[model samples]
Target: MATWPRREYFYYFTKMMPTGFTLTVDLDVTATKEWLAARDLKFNAAYLYLVSKVIAQTPEFRVYRDNTGQLQRFDVIHPAYSVMHADDHSISSLWTAYDPDFTQFYQNYLADLAEYGDQRTPMPKAPQSENTYMIGSIPWTHFTSYTPLPFTPLNTFFPVIQAGKFEQEAKRWQMPLSLTIHHAVADGYHVSQFFEQLQLAFDHPEAWLAS
Candidate 1:
């Protein structure tokens, strides 16, 4: 009989998800520039990639269950955003969870994380997801509201925006982003890193997006 030299489940503890860790961040910026630019959609596309990539790599964005949990880092993320197509405004998403290129991810992630590090963490980062939410399409209008906060439901935001109450509601919800990260591959600092990186990116949008 031949003996196999390797075991498959030796370090199985690192594959579990963490709980009780979710994070929220509030980004305050005006889409006024994005709206005016002929490539406003282009700007939004770049912004989404820049933001999602960072969230995927930073360990802090990952949610950790309480102590005594098994499994390691999950190494994934999910992104939610609104889009437009077919001449109709819609909301869409691209899940960043389980991206294979983490090194490049970190490079992008770090760039944006450095920016909003000064803000507060409203919630712990949630666990990483294997799923994603994709909204359809969107069209520019005088009532377009692009804010970065309020873990409030999407429906709530939409109606309010159309009601011409975007600014008021934005102030009310405090405009903080909420996320859940899988605990298999990261800790809490990654979330903090994410915001910090974002601040850096917004501050230097040109250089940040060029990379």
Candidate 2:
């Protein structure tokens, strides 16, 4: 805490003046979609896996405070997302433990989806872990920008990621990606780096996605 680099900045943002920002960018996912389609994989699951992998690899996105009110960073962050029910369009919140291996994580995601995807309850399918962050998708529409309004204060530093509907533009498939992050834990530079890595992952699915 005393030697932490962003201690003062964190205090200023969390206590003095809370601030958070949301940035939405278009990601080229043409190759990713093609890769998934060839294998008959769900786009939503693949997108979530990529985003979770990026976040877990970035330390700035994994910062959180413990129960004793001490700031800390998780070694990895899991994805907590909503599953829509077909009957009334209600959503069920679910989370899965993140695995570095794509195959393992995808299997875990399928297992959770199978057991709890249809449940209309607000409770998560599995016990939500403290190291988890929110990730979601809006496949029905495309948008340039989106903001998330969480009940917690601005210091809730873990990022919330959302992907909009993908559309074909010229020769590429582009999707809107909105990222909301706490300023206390990261800066615009860190955000840019995260997006760069994310886009790289999208462009090179063969690198991470198990064939």
Candidate 3:
């Protein structure tokens, strides 16, 4: 666990707003589809890979408070996402460690699906860790706005991310991405940086997918 500098304003600001905040934006994912189609890749795997890769670059996204009330930044973070079961029409939450390598991440996601995809009941909650981010997707709808459940007073700093259905228009695809973060750990500047990085990843998937 790494603490923020005492001089940083966020160090004091987070103490007051412990529950955090969120932001939602729509993004062009045309290049993402093209890149995946050229390589015969699964959209969900590629999309999550890009999202996780971009998130790994932002330190503020990995901030969390310890039991003792000290803010800590993790060197790495993983994704804990919701997976729907086809057998029972239920959702199961699963967690997988993050890896920069797209192939490894995709394979791990597949493994997780195989293990929990058919379960009728929810899987056990993932272990609490400073190095985890919450993620989910609603593939059936293309929404303009989204709001997640309210956060408790001591909610962890892990960012919650949701991706809506992608729509095709004039040979291009677009998707809505909603991100909720703790205001104490991140502000508009940090959220803007995250969106910029995510767009770059979507615009140039070949750069990261090749490796």
Candidate 4:
């Protein structure tokens, strides 16, 4: 623990009353959406792909302690997101294993969506992957602020991501994205770094979205 960069912050925050905070920002996704539209790709899958790619590259988001009480960083973190069922207006949790290769990951996402997207059960994939984090969308509303609280707060440290409806202005599309993070694992600076990279990814779809 001596050389761990977040040692002090982790201890201080987790020992306090509240240990996490959520920040929402509007990200311009004009180029990304255009690219997806041209390719006839699902925006939700692409969003999860881009977001998880950035999360894997950011070390702070990958930090967690193991069952043995040893601090460890996951080599990659997968996305466990919500899939809405059109039939009965229900939502089920689905997860796709993270693959750094965008093509492979997108294919995996499509396969999962095809199989379990319409399932009647709440959690089709029960006992989700240990190295997965939450990512979902609220397509019905464009929320300016959102907070997602875990039932067992201190027991989790992974980041929770939520996206709101995207609306286009004169020349650009803006999507409200909220990121909830444990203060022990990250601060505003770290969160800003992640958002900055994410915005860049959204702005330049050709960089990583090309098939």
Candidate 5:
């Protein structure tokens, strides 16, 4: 684990805040959708893998406070998300280890779904790991803005991301993505970096799809 310098006032101030801030933006996902469709890949799995890949490259996204109250950075971050079952219309929490390899990650994700997708009760909360982020998808609606309710105010270091429905505009497809992160761990610049990286990935899906 790595720690940020005490002299970073922004980190100190934002970490002490009662709540985190959210930013929402529309992302062009035309290339991504096309790549996935060509390979018969699951959209959610591919998108989630892209998100994890970007987060792994951004150190700020991995910064979080440990149980001992020490700020630390994780070398790897996992994803925890919700999956809906088609059988009973139930939702369940699913946690999957992050893998840079899209194929491996997608396989593991499918395995988790097959094992617990039909379960009505929420899966036991995974042990709190500062290296994990919460993710959700709302494929039913295309939204311009979103605000996520905090599960806990004390530990808002890890980010919460929600991907809304995709819309077709002429020759392009766009997705609404909302990200909530603790201001202490990152600033607007860091958020912009994430979005920029994500957009690049979407624009060139072949770069990731072949990995």
Candidate 6:
């Protein structure tokens, strides 16, 4: 295992090698009565917690990867976040990635906003053939729309945000998933288990609240 800071090049030349395809059913956020009773914070917190736990313990999820090469456990969940950065400025909050503590995360989020009140930065230009680059000192006027789970690759991620759907994106959306893997880490059953865990967490979110 390597605990290494990402290389600058790591951000550049970003293309993944995909090996396997495991189809999944998307759970409707409001499909069941139990979902509302569970509360929004409950599901959101649990989902973040579970994703954090899985990725922290399993390095594979962090890699832009696939598991077609090995028969190991591919049933792990990865973290995908929605960040709203625009052509002109820096984003003050990264609340979507916080794990297990919404109170602190929300507090910090507000703090960032307050401290940088009305501060706006010029948008950084993106390279040719890509959408706008959305990171750096934030613009005072750019209204932040959202920062949530990243359901797809970076190149193809923003469109979903524009459309506002993950289940539809994951299953029916035009974008395809790409993963590069050595295949030694996971397999079919593992991929199935990943979805099962997600469903279980959604079904039983009361058990996921912080005490």
User: Each prediction's TM-score against the native?
Assistant: 0.40, 0.96, 0.88, 0.95, 0.90, 0.39
Candidate 3 has which clashing residue pairs, if any? Answer: 20-182
lDDT digits (tens) for residues 55-107 of candidate 3: 88888787666778766768778887778866666787777777888889988
RMSD of 5: 2.4
RMSD of each: 14.2, 1.3, 2.5, 1.4, 2.4, 12.0
Q: How close is candidate 4 to the true structure, as a TM-score?
A: 0.95
* Candidate with the larger TM-score of 4 and 6: 4
**Model 1: per-residue Cα lDDT over 145-193, one tens digit each:** 3333345322111100111111324433122344434333334565567
Identify the leading candidate in terms of TM-score: 2
Best by lDDT: 4
- Output the better candidate (5/6) by TM-score: 5
Question: For residues 101-159, could you state the per-residue lDDT of candidate 4 as single tens digits?
Answer: 78899999998888888787877866678899989999888999999857763444779
Assess each prediction's global lDDT (C-alpha) against the native: 0.37, 0.87, 0.78, 0.88, 0.82, 0.34
Score candidate 2 by TM-score against the native.
0.96
Runs in model 6 deviating more than 4 A are 1-18, 28-46, 54-80, 84-184
Clashes of each: 70, 0, 1, 0, 0, 28
Runs with alpha carbons beyond 4 Å of true place in candidate 4: none
lDDT of 1 at 167: 33
| lDDT for predicted candidate 6 compared with the true structure | 0.34
Poorest lDDT segment (10 consecutive residues) of candidate 6: 155-164
Residue 30's lDDT within candidate 2 is 95
lDDT for position 15 in model 5:
46
